[model samples]
Target: MSQTTIQISQELQQELNRMKLFSRETYEEVIWNIIEDTKELSNEAKRDIAKARKEIAEGKAVTLSDLREKYKIQ
Candidate 1:
């Protein structure tokens, strides 16, 4: 792969260093992970979220407390 050098502030460099998963992790991997996390959700995921919200608003969803009581969980 082709490579290029770019300058970053010392603060930004330190932040990136802190984001590394391991001592050997590269800055590029950290950057790509940030990019992936900020990407938009897929259409299906969006629809599912909307459906779940509607169900919650309509009181069609069960509560965690109710499930715990039903299952005799403490």
Candidate 2:
């Protein structure tokens, strides 16, 4: 939405310049990858929450002690 300049270490900048890593294709692919990963995690979180709510509504939920006993954990 807005343009801003980010400062980086001179050594890192020099490395990027030397490698010519500022290509449009590289930037586009990186952004696309980040968005895709975020979407997948969001969907997974929603599914897990829905499952928990369903379990609670169906009276299948347990208390902390129940969980500890079920798992045999201290």
Clashing pairs in 2: none
Number of the top lDDT candidate: 1
Residue 65 Cα positional deviation in candidate 1, in Å, after optimal superposition:
13
What's model 2's lDDT at 67?
92
Tens digit of per-residue lDDT, candidate 2, span 1-74: 57566677899666555544356444335546657767745788889999999999999988899999999999
CA-lDDT, candidates in order: 0.97, 0.71
Candidate 1 at residue 22, lDDT? 96
Write model 1 residue lDDT over 1-74, tens digit each, in one string: 99999999999999999999998999999999999989999999999999999999999999999999999998
Worst 10 residues of 1 by lDDT: 18-27
Which residue pairs in candidate 1 have backbone atoms (N, alpha carbon, C) closer than 3 angstroms, thus clashing? none
Give the Cα-based TM-score of candidate 2 against the true structure: 0.33
